[model samples]
Target chain A: MWAIQLFNGLSYSSILLLVALGLSITFGLMNVINMAHGEFLMIGAYMVYVTQHLFQQYAPAAWFDSYYIFALFVSFTVAFFLGMLLEMGLVKFLYRRPLDSLLATWGVGMMLQQAAKMIFGAPNVAVTSPSWLEGGLQLTSVVVLPYKRLFILALVIVCLLSLYIYLYRTAAGRSMRAVMQNRDMAGCLGISTRKVDRITFAIGSGIAGLAGSALALIGPIGSSLGTYYIVDAFMVVVLGGVGKLAGVVFGAVTIGVLNVFFESWLSASIAKVIVFVIVIAFLQWRPRGFVSLKTRALES
Target chain B: MKQGLGTINRESQFKWIVYMLILGMMLLAPLFLSDFRLMLLAKYVSFAIVAIGLALIWGYTGILSLGHGVFFGLGAYGMAMYLKLEASGGKLPDFMVWSGQNELPWFWMPFSSFFLTLLLIVIVPMGIAYGLGFLTFRNRIQGVQFTILTQALVLIVVTLLIGQQAFTGGSNGITGFKTILGYSLSDPTVKRVLYWITIGVLALLFALAYWMTKSRFKRVLLAIRDGENRLRFIGYNPAVFKAFIFAVSAGFAGIAGALFVLHVGIISPSMMGIVPSIEMVLWVAIGGRNSLSGAVLGALLINYAKTTFSEAYPSLWLFLLGGLFVISVILLPRGFMGLMKDGMQKIKKRRKREDANENNIDFTFGESKR
Candidate 1:
């Protein structure tokens, strides 16, 4: 029973880690709270839904084995483009005013939810896991590990590695890191901080979209899917301390484990409240969170 | 200094006159308006009181709490508990009984007394806000992070309220109040009196807030808003002031919540969620942040529009509200008062330039074209 719970908890944390990565980068670099992130996830889910429909209609049955691979492209490109558009159009002007950006992004989120509702109708939309992705690994009696969850776990690891490589190895990543450290200094050094910001925003949003598509494999997708995860994502980012990848991993695992343990005794809603209280108490003890960085922003 | 004091006295008298005119209008409103409309105004006024508290913290002091709905919810629940107990005639509430609760919970015992209920309503929210503010301020959690924590508070409270069905009446929330202190709530006279009470509280709180904003404490608050570290450098404890204002605002919200339950005749977990909390901020934003009159008027106007639009066009209303938020933040950053102040300045300038452009076709337009 403990193993089953642990496995489930680990997969849950994997999903959380994916969403938190985008949020951490956005917070650490842009310092703008992107409330519409969840909506981007919803858009990704819907994109997967659309791609699946297309695949069923025109793509060969043999090709159907790899529908999610195509779905990934669909979700990522659409979400990335939209994120860039949002940044250029709205979020860019409000960079100096974090409070305004928070509210404005929330407003944008509401509109996105309404737009999704108008397009998809006010109901949960289904996106099926491919046939081969179905079922579980029969480890032993009472210790079965679900294959869908395993797939998610495997995909999360791959994405994390690719993200690390993209962030640490590439020139764009280096410049992005430069911009994150100090925008004015980077701009003076002849780097187009504007381009770096646009790319970072797009990639962050794209990750959220990918996370959303992954979400569809486990559960039904709806306009509110983003709202549900957005708070948890913030909690993870906060508890881990902003700008630390390893912090996110640790936070996710701790939260995931705690939630599972609490769920055994308490109702889901009660468990949620308990988790929130725990986070609050933890925040009280360590306001800068577990991995506090000595940044110029922290002094203010 | 003498001349300044004289002008201040005259300005205060002018404010009193404005207050009287507004109060007179509210007092005479029941005669002109239908009971339903009057009742709606009463509800909106109750909301306006919450907006005033929000204005005190967010506008002047710069602690943008995103979870004030929790405070308001506790106030409503406190009132609801009393009303529920009164309706049940000292037994468990109907829902509790229906859900198989035999013994009366100890918490529900104190709520049986009307005065005690009111006291609890004020103190509980104030206590919660004080505790939260102390922790946040002591730890130096300010700005965007503090706002997010408050949002988390809303989620937590809402979850607990919804989960504890027997106590909180679950998602359905505590409702079906038939009377208050033996006065049948169905009676229009009682409602009118309640409306008057709400307006009375709102006026008194508004005055109190206005007075605070004029005092030395207001400077400390504004300083905290601008830079708390600087205030500390100068040898002042910013945390005390922040926590105090937070508690005071929470108290205001709590009273407003009780008045809200009385006016609207319902209090639910749904009312205390993130949406309502954000809407509370919207009221201050739309009305004119930092202006008491603006907060009150903004609350009344926004709620009036909300009801009218939602009733007339349910499908389009959410879009309208969302669009208003985006437009208000992006376009009208200072809100309605900012626009009004700008227009007033422009008019003053126009008067000075009128002699130069007297022959123009359109006075306002031609001045702009020049």
Candidate 2:
């Protein structure tokens, strides 16, 4: 039973890490709150719904697992283009003013939610797991692990590993890191900071798209589901420390484990309250976040 | 020094006259307008009061608290709990039974009394704000970081309210309130009286805030807003002042929420969500931060426009609001007040130039005659 709970915690943490990583990068590197980050995720979820419809109409006989792959690709592409458009049109002007950007992004988020409602109606749309991903793997007489959860966990690890390599190894990654540390200094050194910002934002939003696709597999998708994850995602970013990739992973794991333990001990509502109190206490101890930026350079 | 004192006195007397005229209009408004319009006006005034608190914190103190909806919600819920209990006639509310709660919870017992409910409206929000401010300000969290934390706080509170069906009325929230302080909420006479009471309370709060701002305490707040590090180096503890002002601002918001419950007769978690909090920030932005009168004017004008726009073109209201935000921030950085001030300065400059030209012509004529 204990092992099952532990696995459950890990599974939950994996999902959270996938959802929050994009937000952490955008906030840490760009200093943009991107209140519409979850909206990007919502867009991704809707894309999957659209893809499922297309598959049903045009390719009914095709393998069901193949549809998931197509949907994931479509989601990333759609979210990436939308994110780029938002950055170029609205977010770029408000880059110097974080507070104003927060308000504006919130407005964008509201508009997106209302638009989603108008398009999809205000109901939870069921997303079926593929036949291959169905059923649980029984580890012991008392312990069982769902295939979908395991798949999500493995996917998150692979995404993180690739992200780690991309951020730390490549020349483009180095330039991006330099820009995040100090925009003016990087610019003075002939680095195209603007391009880096646009690329980073796109990647961040595309990850959110991937998160939404994963989330749809686990639960019903809806217009307002983004609102549910936004707060938790933000908490993870703050607790893990901003501007550090490792911080996001740590934050997600801690919150997920704590939530599961609390839910087991108390009601779900009380568990949320407990998690909030803990975050608040954690913030009190480390206002700059648990992970400090290695370089002390002001970007804005 | 004496002349400066006299100028200040004259300025204050002029302000008093304006206040009296506004108070008189509010008092006589119900006599002319229908009860429904009067009620709508009262709601606007109540929101203006909340905006006033927002203006003080965000406008003057430079602390943008996006979670003010939480404080407002607390006050609304405090009043709703009392009204719900009163409506139940000493029995458990229906929601409690539906949620499998056989009896009212211990924590809810105090809210049954009107006095206790009112006290909680003030104390509860104030306590929460104080605790939060103490934790956050001491840690020196400001800017977007602070804003996100407050947003997170709002999410937690709203979710808690939605999930706890028994205590908080779930997603539907607490409604169907009939009376306040033994007066029928449905009765027009009671509503008129409530309107007058709200106006009186708002007037008193304005006076208090105005007086406080004129004091040395306000100078410190302004200084801190401009340069907190400098103020800290000068031996002032910025955290204490920030926390105190935050508490006061929250208390004012709580009062506004109480008034809102009396007027609207319903309180929902939606009222205190992240969107509403952002709307509150917009009110301050459009009005002119740092000016109390501007804040109230901005709230009334923007909300009035919203109501009218929503009625005329519901589908396009969000687009209009978004456009307004972009236009206001880009064109009128200091808001409407700044634009007005700039216009007045230009007029004054043109008039001065004309006067100087007239003086030069007169001198030439005098010299020619000599």
Candidate 3:
């Protein structure tokens, strides 16, 4: 029972980690909070639903099941470009004012939500899982690890690995980190700080898109799906500490475990309240968050 | 120096005139409007009370609460419990009986008395605000962090209210109230009385907030907004001040919520969720966060526009609202009041320039004659 619960917690954590990474990165690097980041996830989920319909109408029988793979790439690309557009059009102006940025992005989020409602209608639509992921791995009569959960875990690992490579092994990534650390020094060294910001924001948004696609595999897609997960995603980021990759991972795990544990002991709604209360209390204890980086800069 | 003093006196006189004009309009509204419209106006007036509280914290203290709906809802619930009990005539409320609750919950006992209910309406929200402020502000949590914490608080309160169906009437919330202190709620006279009561409360609270803003305490709030660390160095506790102002703001929201329930006739969990909470902030944002009158005006104007727009073109209202938010943040950061202030300054400058030009022309003409 405990083993299965742990698996359930880890699966939940993967989705949280995927969603929060983008928010944490952008907030830490640019000091801008994108309230519309969840909308990007919604956009990605819609892409999956769209792709499913398209494949059903036009694709050959053998190629139909492979539509999920194509949907993943499409989700990332669409969200990446949209993120770039938002960064250039709106975020560029409010980089210095985090609170204003929050409100403006919220406006953007509202518009996006309205647009999604108009296009997809208000009701939730389901995407059928591929036949390959139809069943679970049975460890015992009472213990069955769903293939869907395993697939999501694997997807998150792959995303984390690629993000590590992009942020560490590449020159552009180095410039991005340099800008994050000290914008003036990075600019003086001839790095285009604007370009770095644009790239970083786009990448973060794209990751959210991937999270959306993963989420679509687990549940029905709706216009307001992003709204449901957004607070939880934000909690993960805050609990983990912003800007630190490890912090996000640890935070997600902690929230996920606590959530499952509490749900097991109490009713679901009560468990949710308990989780939020704990996070708030935890914040009171360590306002900077777990694994927070000590910095010489006063404002940070 | 004399001219400057004269201009200041004139400005003060102009401000009083504007205040009186608005006050007169509110007082005379029922004379012109139908009963239905008057009731609607009363609802908007209640919202103005909440906006005033928002202005104190967001505009002056620079603390943004994204979950003010929680405090508002608490006040509404306090009033609602009393109304429901009165309607039930000493029996279990219909929903509670349906939920198989044979007895009244212990929390519902205090609200049976109208006087206690009224007091609790303000006290409960203020107490919660103080507790939340104590927890976050003492730890020096500010900015986006504080905002998120408040949102979490909203999530907790809303879920608990919904989940405890037997106690809170579930998602439908506490409703079906027939009377208030034995007066029939459906009676037009009662409604008119309530409307006048709303207006009185708004005027009294508005004056109180105005006076508070002009006091030395306002300077400390401003200082905290500008430089908390500097204020701390000069020997002041920013946390206590922030917490006190936050509690005071919650008290105002509580009053607004009670008045809102009295006018609107129902309070639901959906009303106090994240969306409505954030919308409360937008009212202050659009009205002019720094000005008290602007906050009231914002609550009235935005809500009126929302009703009219959504009524006429339901599909387009969200788009317009979204666009207004973006535009207000980008171009109207100081809001409508700030724009008016700028326009007044421009007119004064243009008049001065014209006078200087006339003087120069007169001097040239005299030189030519000589």
The candidate, 1 or 2, that scores higher on TM-score is 1
Model 2, position B77: C-alpha lDDT score: 88
lDDT of 1 at B81: 88
Give the DockQ (C-alpha) for candidate 2: 0.44
* lDDT of candidate 3 over B89-125, digit per residue (tens): 9999999989899999999999999999999999999
Q: Per model, how many backbone clashes are there?
A: 0, 0, 0
Instruction: Give me the runs in candidate 3 sitting further than 4 Å from their true place.
Output: B356-370
- Report candidate 1's interface RMSD in Å: 1.5
The sequence of per-residue lDDT tens digits that candidate 2 reaches over residues A271-296 is 88899899889887877777868665
Clashing pairs in 2: none
Q: Rank the candidates by lDDT, best first.
A: 3, 1, 2
Worst 10-residue lDDT window, candidate 1 chain B: B359-368
Indicate the docking level reached by candidate 1: medium
Model 1 TM-score, 2 decimals? 0.95
User: Candidate 3 has what TM-score?
Assistant: 0.96
TM-score for chain A, candidates 1 onward in order? 0.95, 0.96, 0.97
lDDT digits (tens) for residues B7-41 of candidate 1: 56986798789889999899878888888898899
After the best TM-score superposition of candidate 2, give how far the Cα of residue B203 lies from its true spot, in angstroms: 1.4
Model 1 stretches with alpha carbons more than 4 Å out: A296-300, B1-15, B350-370
